[model samples]
Target chain A: MSLLEKISDQATTLTPGERRLVENVIDSPTSAALGTAGELARAAGVHEATASRLAKKLGFVSYAAFRDALRDEFIATRETATRFEKTIAESTSDTILGELAREETQALGRIEEFITPEQISEAAQILMRARRIFVYGYGNAEVLALLMVKRFRRFGKDTHQLGTDPRGLAEQMLGLDSDDAVLSFAFRRPPRGYAALMETAKEVGARTVMIAGKSGALLTPRPDRLLAAPRSGDQDAFQTLTVPMTICNAIVIAAGLTAKEESLKKLDRLGQLIERFE
Target chain B: MSLLEKISDQATTLTPGERRLVENVIDSPTSAALGTAGELARAAGVHEATASRLAKKLGFVSYAAFRDALRDEFIATRETATRFEKTIAESTSDTILGELAREETQALGRIEEFITPEQISEAAQILMRARRIFVYGYGNAEVLALLMVKRFRRFGKDTHQLGTDPRGLAEQMLGLDSDDAVLSFAFRRPPRGYAALMETAKEVGARTVMIAGKSGALLTPRPDRLLAAPRSGDQDAFQTLTVPMTICNAIVIAAGLTAKEESLKKLDRLGQLIERFE
Candidate 1:
């Protein structure tokens, strides 16, 4: 596997500082591979020693070996170019939809090679056991947060979403405790106050899970659990949300499947209520 | 191509009534084929003659031939079960994420066979020219609506989201004219007001577009244009949003590509404002 791919494959096992290094490398592989160990460490807000340790963990003899691996991988992939770019060049309206679909499908497939299934199951378990779950998605991501709230609520879980209210968000985050879990979707151009909300969760010792794209590297202090779903498509073209949404679907489904008995009982009760009331 | 594939391949060219017939056939091909022409027509809320016309349109001599073709295709696919069910049965935390990714990727690929690029480009053009674009999302689809609002607004389009506002929604729809366009994301178990909202849009002569799943058959009076992104994965497993989100991405990209100069200018202005202010 390539260095970045190897880092992602082991993302769940890495420490926060280590994951930051992985995120940094992913954000700009060319620069990350060419830069000195100190330069890379500073960029990721980690010590040089931590950076070296990360490199070794990924099976590199030294940081230089890791950089070499990244360079080799980058060159190999660049020679072929992304499939989406080729699709755009050749596609007519008649053929573009299929190309778009196939590209997205390939994105989901690529994410599979990097993100571990254990990470998904672990995140689901955290959500299931929490006393209450607070979901937030700013700007466009807010809808995703609402979806999470809807899914968890269907199973009789106490879930709440912080809508378009920054003040309300601050209040909500302040109230979370260790028994609570905060699940937030922080995608590209993440809304203001993301850091504050995450900080509050940390202060109260709440479990934090972030569903984010590659720009997740900018999240200064990362969440306790990170489910990275890399966004695909040309930067100038369009940003696809398939990866993150798919992750959301999988996490919800895994939770439901793991808690099948309880979920079914709650669903039955909900059905009765709907029938009686509606 | 098979009958179903033929319908999808010509998605952009089909009429509203003919499109409804295609949707009905796709929703449950087994029933669409086994039932008489009149039965299929009734289910699609169209006349029996329309169903016959649809079959002929797909190059079949009679509706019976279309049914035979559907049965043949269905049987050929049934020998192999869904990859998701197999994944669920054998999954360890180590393997589940990859399985989820692959399944969702396949979902996108499946949608490609149905949704056409012309449909995407057309949706983009509608949003671009509208005096005002009113976006709505029912239940889980609300996120898609919000996403549309964010994307269009970034490109400096006049857009508004009918956010959880039944009273406001009713009032807003009252103001629409032929120059206006209403786009709604209505998926499974749509909200109560979906019909009312669509009705109001029609009464005002506003162009209407719907981004929906196959169950769009449940829609009372279909919109002027329909962009269908089929739901993927097993019925009992978690529902994936990859297909719809991918469609959204493609539409926005097509819109940006079509109106290149204006979008870039707006983005540039926005960048300057952000740099100077916050």
Candidate 2:
């Protein structure tokens, strides 16, 4: 914890008077309390000159040091808030409907943070023209790849998943030529051989895109494009890729939107077929 | 919950007047409000106007706004000082330590926000020398075929993964070729495929690296090096890779460190035995 957080905890546990003193100056500047201990004491409902005394109790030699603690707290709190807010901008947790209003607000923030006409146009163009397009990944990405495959099939692209296989995978790659495009979803660590494939895909003239982490440029040697998630490696665990995944899905949808009228009609038909079959 | 965290939450239940109002403000902007108008009013010891009165709620709106309704209470409470204190330092919940005194103080404050030099080097080195890498990705990375396989083992490198046939996943990928590397694991929506192969080891690979999610990257990429983890995806009733599954475990720890010496020593021993036995 930063000094501010420490002070906050210590302040709250102390006697009301001392706690009051701790609270007021916790976010204050060191200079604020030095000569004005009397003023701060009055403001906090403590002895007129208690600020310095409280500082001493808290282990600071003078009110100036306490003020410094407060300033540090303020800054740390600010930084944390900004980072947390950034994560929330993209975060999509389950069953947060009760927060619809806030959710909408946050959504807007996210949209503004990233959406650009160039991005929409480019992503859309890629989706529209991708030949032999494949959304390759494992885990959650498997489901996403399936969805993309289904979505793109309506546009008349021949897409297939790289199911669990070793030799078969090699054989499959041998069939592809430069005209094909693959959207490989290896965000964080980029899988064992993921980066190697991007290198090969490019060698084979296949267009590849990466949606990944805030680490070494391990994966994308030949990536035609890269989308760095708003949330980096830091907040990954406490939070899942709920935020970035949603953003990527939206990109797919946006790309679909730009794929033109016939594509939408085709999608409807495809959905109808799949629905009927189910 | 860590001791630090429990106390952070308890800070909110405090009476407004009873708290070091300034310190609470610095700690959490929305905290002073209890999310209920009456509760907020009661907590702050003020009328609605007085609560609305402190509109500079610094980080929040009026006290009325902060507690009007719970949108994502989880969001509000999730990232606290303790959580940030660790993750920013790259110290996450994967380990069990939560000691406040022993905590890495500068880790959070000085977090790289991006990847660290050490992490990059470690991941890169892992990928450079894999003899044969077999990646097993069930749900999300089903399409990761060829992506990981073709990437690492490019130019005839022996990188492999589960074949499309789920049944052959174990035996096929485990047939280590020339100091093989096993990169098999599951991701969001864990598949039975990975769980089945968890115990197998590639005779060819020198070492193993396992990457799992917050929940075991849904079951660690078995046999070795672990990367970031546990990104479960739920888009509909189905959350597809909320985080990129394949990429999450894509850490090439071999980028910097070389367990090659030990691996080579074992490989040499195994090769001689295989030659003599065969």
Candidate 3:
């Protein structure tokens, strides 16, 4: 069995501190794989001894052995080439499309299981109250950042997308203030500039919201509001954006609904402008 | 009962030609509402009289009356304001998130019912053979376009996103050749540069593929390959990106799987580059 499976198998017997460490390990495997036992305990807000106890509880010889196994498991499973090979080996060309669709559909169906209505409402409330919204995402996440900026702007919020380049990002960060909010998308591991952006937002007292994968729960300085869920597939498989995109839509809709009258008026004006121009 | 309901109810009695016209109307209500009977018939590749016959069969006094009702229904049901209002009226603030999630889940589940494995393979095959790929989307669709460009590039395809601006689009189109492919996303209606993009691709003999809503089935000078499905919710609700994003993911995976070895090599190189840079 995998390290995570072994950890979960012992869930009922773990002490509170041990349980906290176990949860942190599962939530951020990358950190668990890369960090020492003390760092893991500190990040999980637990006693250092809990990590070694949890390791023994899971039948490992020692804490170092447990860490070695975890690092090995992480590297073996998450290498992009290994993951892609597994995906290709599991399905022939004829079945790949159906398999992917099924995976994504199942993922979409599970959104409510991982994300709560309360979390969405909390994030939306922050978005509704912010004077301006700056979105941060990189790689595939950037597509979502652009999407959020466009949709939020349509709902009458002042919105901007932060560039991925460090220089441009620093320039943009200069404009943030207490009245603003930062909405970011992160999956798997946090992106470059994530720490700087979060620190700047904190420095300026801006409300911060993040839509991310489960790993987001372990972010050192967590956002003001977090809506985190697992993506559609195993950590090793190619994941789709369906789940996160649904969360984004829900957040936008919820925010718009929070101030119904004003949102509708903005949409009405948008419709008129489209009709006039197009 | 709604006009669409009436048409479906009479499905058993429709002639082949009448069925064609009904399908066209169901697929592209905007066209049915705004176009003349002859134009609608021609678009559906049916006899002009078939439009009138379908109208009469649906209990309308004349084709013009049918068109008028369709126009009214289309406008009343599809206006952004009306749709947003309906969404707002259907649920309390507490239930909106769950409701939207449910709607998107249902839509994602229905993807296989609308699209076929063969269609995905055909699109993927085109992508595999293309020397270059160009993606076009405007407004919200631009998000999907950006996503396709980024992912396809990762898989080692020469990919570019077609700008929404006419002058820039024309400049980009100048580079198209028979070795290239153009992929577009259109929902509700074709975007501003769609006609020119399609025409230019045709002139350059480039392969063309479109992922669109049902309305795309009737695009004049239709693309060489079309993968069309309905967005979540009715015609007017604030649609989420879940469905289209899922399709985009599937296409990307399918295309990569078509030439697995090369794609894996590219991904490995990407990983190494990331390891070196970080």
Residue B98 local lDDT, model 1: 62
lDDT tens digits, residue span B1-278, model 2: 43234335656664454244434443453333223444444555556554444433432455534443222232222123234334333423211111111122211211211112233234435555655556666544544443445445432456666764665765585465555555544443355755445445533435554443333322333344444322322211222332233233223212211322222112123223222321
Candidate 1 segments exceeding 4 Å error: A1-96, A163-166, A188-191, A215-218, A234-237, A261-278, B1-94, B163-168, B189-191, B215-218, B235-238, B261-278
lDDT of each: 0.67, 0.43, 0.72
TM-score of 3: 0.62
**Could you give the CAPRI-style class of model 2?**
incorrect
The digit string of per-residue lDDT tens for model 1 on A158-218 reads 9998755878777767678989998988766666777888888888899988898877757
- How does model 1 fare in lDDT? 0.67
- Candidate 1 CAPRI classification by DockQ: incorrect
Clashing pairs in model 1, backbone N/Cα/C closer than 3 A: A137-A142
Tens digits of per-residue lDDT for model 2 on A1-278?
33433443354346778766654543222323232578778878888666666777767777766665544332222333344321211122211111221222232233323434355346556656767776676644554466566556655667777653555556667767787877766654665457556666878887776655444245546377665544322323211233344445445444545654333322233223333322
Alpha-carbon interface RMSD of model 1? 16.4
**Model 2 segments more than 4 A misplaced:** A1-151, A154-248, A254-278, B1-77, B80-130, B143-157, B167-171, B177-179, B202-214, B217-250, B257-278
Deviation (Å) of B174 in candidate 2: 5.7
- In candidate 2 chain A, what residue range of length 10 has the lowest lDDT sum? A89-98
On the 0 to 100 scale, the lDDT of residue B180 in model 2 is 53
Ranking by DockQ: 1, 3, 2
- Highest lDDT: which candidate? 3
